[model samples]
Target chain A: MQGDFYQLLKEQGYVLGMSGQAGVGQALTTATTILAFKYRDGVLVAGDRRATAGNMVMYDRTDKVLEIDRHSVMAIAGVPATAYEMVRILEHSFKYYRRTQLQELSFEGKLRALSKLLKENVPAALAGTGAVVPIFAGYDAEQESAKIYFYDILGAEFEGVEYAVSGSGSPTIRGILHYVNTWGEQPLSAMSEEQAAVQALRLLTSAAEFDSATGGVNREAGLYPVVKLITPNGVTAMADPHLRSLFESNVSKGS
Target chain B: MYEEPYRWVEAVGNRRQYLDAQFAQGSPVVGVSCDQGILLMTMSKGTPKLYEIYDRLALGGMGHPADLEKLRFTLLEMAHVEGFNRSASDVTGSRLIKYGIAPVVKQAFEEVFKAPFIAKLLLGELGQKAGKDGFLTINYDGVFEEKNRYAVLAASSSVEQRMVEYLRPQSCVSLKDAVDLAIHAWAIGDRAQRHTDDTGGDPKDGKGSSDQPVADSQTLMTHIRQCMQGKSIECVLLDRHVAGTSKYRTLGSGELETLLPKDLSSALT
Candidate 1:
C-alpha cells in the first residue's frame, strides 16, 4: 500500500526517500551518521545528533536518522530532501522485495543506488549543493554476514575502510573514524561503549579542534560530541550528558 | 546445480540412510553428512505464523542463522497440520529436498503431534563442552538451544565446527520431534567422524567428535539418548564425557532398552 503511495510519488518526479518521518528527534531526518566497526561477529552504525541547513545547525536533538527497518538504517545529510527520499526508496524496496531479497544489500548495491539518485539530481546537487550522502549497514543474508556503506556528494559510494562516515563534517568525521578504527579496530563490538565513546570523542574533538564544522557535544567545555551506535540489536543514540565525562577526560588530559 | 552431481546427492543420501539405519537398529547413534546444508520443511507458506517467524528472523539474524525462527514457525504450522513452504520447493528444488523428512508427510506427522512446531539446530550446540580454555562449560536440560534465526552454525568441520540442521514436523502430536531431532544428531555425529578423519582433528582427544551437533548437546549423554531413541543400546559411546558423566549421575549401566519395550529394544540393542 505504502509502495503504491511511494510509486505515486516517484511518478510525480519527487524523489522517493526524501519524505522525512518527523518525530521527537529528527525533524526531516536529513542527517549525519557513523556506524561501529564490523567485528568478527557483527557490525555497528553510529551518527551524530545534528542536522544542518548549510551552515546553520537546524536541529541538535534530532537523531540525524533512525532505523527505517530494524537491523539497518539510512542515515543521510546534505539536503534533507536527499536524506528523506533515499530512506523512502529503500524502505519501500525492502517491503516489496523482502521475501525474495536477502537481508543486506551488497556494498556495491548500496553505493550504486546512491550514485544513481545523486547523478539524477545533477541540477540541484551541482548548483548550490543539495547533494545527498548516506551510510547503509546491515547483515547480508546471502553473505551470511554484516557490512557498512558510505556515499559521497556525486552519489559515489564507498565501503569505508572500517567505519562509514557521511555528512557535512565527514572529512573531519572521517578523521575521527580513522583514529577509532586504528585503535578500536574495524569491528567495534569487541570493545566497550566507553572505548568507543573515547574514540568518538577524541575524533569529534579532534575534528572540532581543527575542522570548525565538526564539534563534540561539549561545544563550550570546548568539545561538543554526540554519537549513536548501530549494533545487532539496533540503533543507540548516545546523549551529550554521557558524552561530557568522556569529553572532559580528553580536555583534562590536554590541560 | 539442478542435477546436483551424484557425489553430492549420494553424500546427502548417505546421511539419510544412516538415520534410517539408526531407526532400523533401534539405535540412537546417527551421522548426517551434507555439502551445503539441508532445508527441513516446517510449515506451509503464507501463514501468519510463518510470517511472524520470518519477520523476527529478519530483525534478529545478525550473528546467527535467522532461518530457525521460520523453522520453528514451520514446525508450529506442521504441528497444527498446516501446509508449508511451497516457495521453497518451487524454487530451491533438490537442494531443499536433501533434508531427512519429506514435505508431503510433514503435515501428517504434525497433525499427529498437534502442537505444530519447527526447529533449526545450530552445529555449535551439538558437541562436547569445556576443554583447554574452560569457555565451553554449560548446564541446561536440552543439550542445545532452539536459538532464534541469528544463530545458525556455518562451519564445515567435524573437528571444532559442528553442523546446523532443520526439521519438518509431519504432525502437531509432537510425534516426530524426537525422531527427527535424533536423526539430525545422527547425521551430525557421523559427519563429524568422517570430517575428523578427513581433517585430522584427532577427535578422540580433541572435542571427542569432529562432527559434533552444532547445538553442543553433551552428545555423549543427551544425543546418545537422542541417537538411539527407539533402540536397545546402552549409552552411545558418542562422547566419552557424556558416558563418564552418566556414570557420575549413577544412571543405570546405559541399558537403554530397559527404558523401553524389549521387543522394540532388540531392534537396535
Candidate 2:
C-alpha cells in the first residue's frame, strides 16, 4: 500500500548481505591514512593511497588530501567509503552555508560537520564496520594563520597543538613527524609549488619507509593523488612530473 | 581585373562610437544585451579598448546609497529585453523604472560595409532575441515568464558589470604545459568576466552557473566559442539580408556553445 502512494520499503522485508555481519548491500569499511603539518605558508596535508580491509589490502592509490573550502584542505584516513561520502556531504553543506551565511564558516565549524558525518556512520564502524578519522587543516582568515583540527567516529573533535595524524599509517606517520623539522602557520602569502612538493614527499615517504599500509609516491597516474594547501589560496596537487622530480631529488640528496 | 568581387569596404565612421550621439536627459545607452545578462556598454574605445560593465543602476528612487544592497540581488538576474518585471507586490516593487519603447537601432553605418563586431553581435543573436525593454504596470503578478516582458532598468542596478574569475582544466602531457594552459584559461576567464558580466561567479562555478544543467564537456566547449568573439553579436546577417532589409537569421538551439577555461586556452593557441 505504501507503494500505492510511495510507501516505505521496510514493510517489504527485503533483507540482504554476506561478509561477517548484516552487510546488506552496503560497502565494506577499508581503512586508509591521512597526515598533516602546518608550515609558515599554509597548512599541508599528506595521505597515502592504500585502504586496507582487516589485514587484507582492499585498494591501492586512494586520495586522502581534499579541498574543504576555498582556504582549506582535509587529510583523512579510515574507511575509504565512509570518508569519501563524508567529504561529498561536507562540500555540499559548505556551499549551502557559504551562500546562506554571508560570513565564511570557521575551521571549527568544518570539524563539527565532519564529526556529525562520522557519528552517523558509527554503528557500521563498530560492527566490523568501518569509520573515518580525519585530520583537518585550513587557513583561518580571522587569525591569519593555518589551524589544525581532528575528529573521531563519535563526533569528538580536538585541535592538536603541533600536528595531527589519522588513518592506517597514523602510528608510523606520527612517529616520523616528531622529526619533521617544522610545523606552524606563517607570514608568507603562499607555499610555492616546490615547497609543497617537498613537504608532500616528506610525509608520504615517512609512511612508505615505516608503514606497509601506505603506498609510495605515485609519479605517473593522475588518479589517487596527494595535495598541499597553503594560505589564502586553496589546496593544490603537485603535478606528476613535479612529484617525480622531487622524489628524484630526495634520492640524490639522501645518497 | 583590378576590381575584386569578394572584397571588403571600409565601414562608415567609427562602429565603436555607436553611443556617441548626445544622450540628453533619459536617453538609451548604447550597449549589447549579453546572454550573461550584464550591462556591457562601451564607455570609451581608444588605446586599451575600454568597456564599462553596469552591474547595477536604475532611473528611479530618492537616490540613496543604502538601496545598493537590495539592488545587488535584483541585478543578479535582470537584463534588457530580458529584465525582470515584478508586479507592485513583488519584492522590490517601488524600485522599478518606467520608460518608453523604442527600437534601439543597431547603427545604420553598420551595414554598407563590414563591422568590427559582426562576429560578436551575430554570436549573441545566436542566444536570445526580441523582447520588451521599457516599463511595466504595478500589480501582484504571478510566476514571471515570457508573459511579463515589459520592464525597464530598476534604479538599484549599477551600470558597472562585476567581473567573474574562472579556472581552466588543462589536459596536458607535461607539467609545464598544464601550468601554461591553466594560466591561459585564467587570462581568458578574466577577460570574459571583466569585459562582460563582471559580477558572474568565478569560472570554477562552470556548469553550476549555467541555466541549462551543462553536464557533459561539450556544452562548455560551445560557451568558450561564443566568449572569445569579444563583441555581443546579435544576428548572423547574410549578404542579401545586410544589403536589402537589414535582416538576419535566428540561430537555432544548440547553435552556440559555452567554453570552459581550459577550452578557451586551447583556442588561444
Candidate 3:
C-alpha cells in the first residue's frame, strides 16, 4: 500500500483539531504576515516572527516559514497550534510518499494533500478556533520553474501568479505588492535575490507599522523576519546577519 | 491438514528449507559505517536493492522484489508516522525492527497457513556522532540482530557470517575506502553463494570449506569481475556532513566512477 502518514495517524485515533469544543470567548494564538512572490531566479517567501493571542504578543521569535522538503516550504499565517500540526503532517506525508512510492509526489498531488487536510479541519475552522491560511511555495522540478500557491481556511487553493499574502496584515501588504508590481520601476519577478529580500523586509516593516498583530523587525533584540528563497537549486533560508545588514543598508536607508 | 502439533512443526521446517532455497541466487548487500556516514552497497541486474527508509536510516535487502517492497513500505509508514507524532530522534532502527517489523514478520512466519516473507534485510542508522552508528539484520524467520559499525545481508546465514568475519576488524575513514571495502565484502558473499551453487549442495555444507580461507585481494578482484558481468553497483550514503534534515543520497554512476579504483571502474564497461 502507498504510505500515508496522515491516514495512519487518523487510524490511531489522533485528531488534528482542538481537544474540546472551541468557545467563542476563547482566544487562540495566531501568527501572521506571510508573503511569497516570484523573483528573478525563483520565488521568495517571507514571514514575520510575531505570534499573538488576542491583543497580547505571545512570542516574537516564531519561525513562520517552515521548510517542508528540499524544494518546498509552507508559510503559515493563522492559528499557530493548528498550522504547526498541518505543517508537520505535510512534511511527513511528502517524505512518506517519496520513500514508499519510490518517487516524489507530483506537484498536483501535493496541492491536493494540503487541500484534503484543510477540508478535514473544517469543523475546527468553522468554530473560529483553529484556522490556517497558508501560502505554499516551491520549485516545481517537472516544470523547471518555481510556483506559489495560496489556500483559504476552507481549502480553496489558488495559484498566485506574481505574489500572494495572508494573515491579519495581508491587506496592507497585498496593496503594496500590487502597487509596486504594477507601476514600480520593475516588476516583482524581475528583481534579483538580494533585491527581493530587501523588498520583503520593507514590506513586513510596513505591515507592522499599520497592523497590531504584525511584529516587524526588532532592531533592539536583533530579530529579523524569516526570509527564504525557492530556486531550482533548493530552498535556502536567509540568515539573520544577512537580513540585518540588508535592512540596515538598503531597506532602512531607503525609507 | 496439520492437525497434529508435530505435523505443524514439520511443515514449518519445510518452509524454512524452501525459503532458503529461494534466496540461494540472490545478491548480497553490504553496509558499513565510515567517517562520512553509513554506506550501503549491492549488485543487481535491474531492480534496486538499496533504499532510503527515513532521514537517518537506509535499507538494503536480498529477496523477491515484491516481498522486499512490502516490508519497505511497512517500515516507511511506521517510521514516518512515529516521526510525525513523536520526533525524528525517536524513529530509530532498533525501535522499528523490534516493535514494528519483527512482530508482523514473526506472525507471518508462524501462521503456517500464510506464506512467509522470503527476504533478508540490512538496516543502517546514521548516528548523531562518530562511533554511534548502528546496523541491524533481519532474517526471513523474523530473527534479527543489532550490531555496531557494520552488517551484511546475504542469501544464507553462512554467507552472511563469512562476510561479517571479513569486515569485523576493518575500519574505514573515508568514503572511497568504505566503498572499496564494501565491494570486497560483497564479493566474498557472492563468491560463497556461487561456490555453493557449483557444488550443488546445501549452503550450510559449503560453509565448511569457506570458513578457513578469507579470500585475498586478487581473488576478490577476480570474483568481483566475474560476478559483476551483467550487474550494476547500487550504492547509497547517509552522509552526516550534508546540510539538511535528510541525509540519504544515492551515489550516481558519475560519482561512483571517482570512488571506485581505476581498474574496477574500467572493467564495468
**Candidate 1 local lDDT, B181-203, one digit each (tens):** 43344445444554444555533
Docking class of 1: incorrect
Q: For model 3, what is the alpha-carbon lDDT of residue B250?
A: 94
User: What DockQ results for candidate 2?
Assistant: 0.01
> Cα miss at A185, model 3 (Å)?
2.2
Kindly list the per-residue Cα lDDT of model 2 for residues B1-269, writing each as its tens digit: 21343331322333332311111111111122222221211111121111110112222111122332233222222221122122112322222222111111122223434322111110011112333222121111111111121121111112111111122122333223323232333233323333223444322232213322212335434643554465321111111212211122222212322222455445544
Residue B87, model 3, lDDT? 96
lDDT of 1 by residue, A53-115 (tens): 445666655444546555566666566655565665555344333332323444345445556
Better of 2 and 3 by DockQ: 3
Show the lowest summed lDDT stretch of 10 residues, model 1 chain B.
Answer: B132-141
DockQ of each: 0.01, 0.01, 0.84
TM-score of chain B taken alone, every candidate:
0.22, 0.18, 0.96
Cα misplacement distance, residue B149 of candidate 3 (Å)? 1.5
Every prediction's TM-score for the first chain?
A: 0.67, 0.76, 0.97
Candidate 2, residues A1-255: lDDT per residue as tens digits? 200100111133411111146455554545555766666566667777776655666767667788755677767776665666566556545533442233456766766767766666677666545556788788778777778888876678888665788866678767656654444243112445566557557766666667777776654554333756556765566666666666777643553
- Fnat (0 to 1) per candidate: 0.00, 0.00, 1.00
For model 3 the local lDDT of residue B18 reads: 86
Say which candidate scores most in DockQ: 3
